[model samples]
Target: MNLEWLKGIYVPILTPMKEDESVDFEKLRKQVNFIIDGGVHGILAHGSNSEFYMFEDDDYEEIFKVILEEVAGRVPVIMGIGAIRTSKCVKLAKLAERLGADAVAILQPMFLKPTDEELYYHFKTIADSVKELPTLLYNNPRIGYTLSSDLVERLARDVRNIVGIKDSSGDINQLLEFIRKTRDLKFKAFGGKDTLLYSSLNIGAVGGVCTTANIFPELVTSIYNTYVDGDLKESLELQFELNPVRMSMDKASFPVATKDMANINGMDVGKPIKPNHASPSGVVESMRKEMAKAGLLKG
Candidate 1:
């Protein structure tokens, strides 16, 4: 387990595309720098929020290359190597390693709902295939798959490269279970929800890999830092301040709300993928007003 690079808030960035659906390299670069400059500890390109499943192999390769080049070591680039097929995941993992990604975050195989043993084999197979790079298990149950805390412990014990787990289950009990069960191991656990950030840390989480960080990087990072620094009151206050923005996500498709918020704040991260419509203008305006009220946006 590579515990050294798994701490603090890691922003799962949204993929910016032009109106014609081409990859917007310029905006992509700007967005990367935006989050890094805003104080995020790491950038995760092509994760769920980044439309990882929508991209082809070539598209992923190109995006990974651009992200690695733009990030340029300012922060670790954690590339999403999640795929429906283990073989393909391994290929992407190897490509990420070659392209200079600091780590690879993989989601469990969706649709099939593999058994605990099968899930273990799936991750172990990929981890074995990519021995040189660290693997962060992404347990996002909302997306159709869930990795149990017991399975996480088993993986941590068995797979040498299985370094961390991101619990997006939104269940504090599950998050705490992972923390408690894996305490003796070298594995790292992170809260996957923006709302659960404070509690997750209170239970011994290393940090967070949150979609909300796409818009409120400083506030999110502050929550993690303040909590780690022992200022629980300030951290909780900041967490509460960002709740509306995080809750706004439940009102629309993911990256859509997140990307719109980014553009409203002046980052212009292009548009969401097809079928995932950008939020309505009214929703955008309301979010803008909320952001201003929260002091996240300048007048």
Candidate 2:
């Protein structure tokens, strides 16, 4: 396990689909290579941006295999196995471990509220199943319930392999509490929200896993690298510059806008898996403006 896993920007690599809505392995390879070449510390294959919910079990496994092979140890590939079912999550963890993923990130399954103990058992079972690989607890209450700071601390204490947590809540207090609780315990914290990237770092998070990076890798990664390089002024500058892009996205379907960025870059990663609407064409111009302002416009 890479103890220092949360060191820099990680892009949740998009699942490229051809016109038929099938997995585009060829485009996925290009997407992975493009982001790597553009400069990212890691790649997350089946995160929220990857539309993990839409993919079937066999297809999910196949996608992970493609990502792992494409990455080829160039950087750590953190596989997202955060399923709603405990037994299935355990099974998924085994698959991730077997397929050569560096780590697994699990989220609470579905939209039901569970007690702290239930959440504990849920994470514990998954960790125990893949005891050899490191586990990251994902705290994004919007999808499922948030992992309370106490629960996180308890998990860090008991789950020996639980090395980190990604907080997407956008709550500074919760993030600060997480950092405080886990610092001495040798646990790391990362940002799961792009909007909180700067502040999350200010409060001692190592880095982040963000969707915006899938669109503008250089610009998104600069926020972390510039801060780490000791130029706080430039780092904040980059963050503020991204505000319009984030604002524009707030009014639209998120992953849809994200795929728009990829398309603008000359790669058609397709739209978000259905039930949700595809991004409005208007959002693309707003994103383009932001990208151009940050000097990220494609040639």
Candidates' lDDT values, in order?
Answer: 0.85, 0.84
Candidate 2 has what TM-score?
0.95
Give the distance in Å from residue 204's predicted Cα in candidate 1 to where it truly belongs: 0.5
lDDT per residue for candidate 2 within 229-284, as digits (tens), equals 99999999999987677666675675677777777767777766777666667877
Residue 237 lDDT in candidate 2: 91
With candidate 2 superimposed using the best TM-score fit, by how many Å does residue 142's alpha carbon deviate from the native? 1.8
lDDT of 1 by residue, 1-299 (tens): 44686799999988889998889999888888878988999988877888888888888899989989998899988888778888888888888888888888888887786889888888999888888788889898866867888899999888888888888999999888888888998889989888889888988999999887887788899999999899999999998998877776676666688888888887778888887888998888888877887888854
After TM-score superposition, what is the CA distance of residue 259 in candidate 2 from its true location, in Å? Answer: 0.8
Those runs of model 2 whose alpha carbons end farther than 4 Å from true positions after fitting are none
For every model shown, the clashing-pair count is 0, 2
- Model 1 lDDT at residue 11: 90
